[model samples]
Target: MSVDRVRTAAAARGLEIEIRESPRASSLEEAAALRGITPADIVKTLVVKGRGDQYLFALIPGDRSISWPKLRALLGVNRLRLPEPELALEATGYERGTITPLGSTRDWPVYADERMTGRRVSMGAGAHGWTLFVDADALIASYDATVADISDPIETIR
Candidate 1:
């Protein structure tokens, strides 16, 4: 199972995490309420396509979304788009909402929005209805992710 792979990876890295079941939540808002955290604390994992079939894993706060301009500038790429769902699953070994960098099939490059630091965030656990509650800094460091300002609040953007 994907969640088991995630747990194995965490153990190999000496990181401890708790996987919370969230089968009843129908939306991000509801999930946050169930997790007892503010909506902004949920982290969304996005799979973005770059030039020549390259892909990147972007971590954005649930209340915000990617800023293409900033991401392109940071990546020095001219074109980037969210891949079709099937392609994402093929690349990450986890379905859309359950994708996480922790146990991806490939250790694709990771980037995190600067805002997530020091927050206790809920992110997908590689399974439906499950989320991993983790310390942002610990997660980022464990994954060796590049942290940068690459997103804007959803309302502020579009």
Candidate 2:
């Protein structure tokens, strides 16, 4: 049902997307490897809670992490946090790992890291054991997402 929702949403936007069944991986790197792509090509759809009941979807590359200060300044807000899993599900109609703006129950605003532009990226398919692939530029246009440098490269433990 969730995947169906995703399909319908994509169709409505005239955005072509590919949904593939995948075995759930334990980590971001592994997920990318399984998909035969670099970690950077995997986009993470994160739910960020703003003030009150407001929330937004952040599309960050897998090899990066949200830069709180940068994001705050970009949004002109002093506070933002990742809400609890239950709250995320309630907000997006999809669980944490399966959350994508395409099929969300609510049309939350989307913010995308600039690095994700000009590439085809894989992301959540609104269901477990599935992945959705789409052109990042098209997705940005489809959602009217704000594109900026709102993320930092993920530091790896040496």
Give per-model CA RMSD: 1.7, 0.8
lDDT, residue 98, model 2: 92
Candidate 2 residue pairs that clash: none
lDDT tens per residue, model 1, 84-103: 99999998999999999888
lDDT of 1: 0.90
CA displacement after TM-score superposition, residue 44 of candidate 2 (Å): 0.2
Ten-residue region with minimum lDDT total, candidate 2? 22-31
TM-score of each: 0.94, 0.98
State each model's CA lDDT, in order. 0.90, 0.96
lDDT of 2 by residue, 25-67 (tens): 8998898999999999999999999999999999999999999
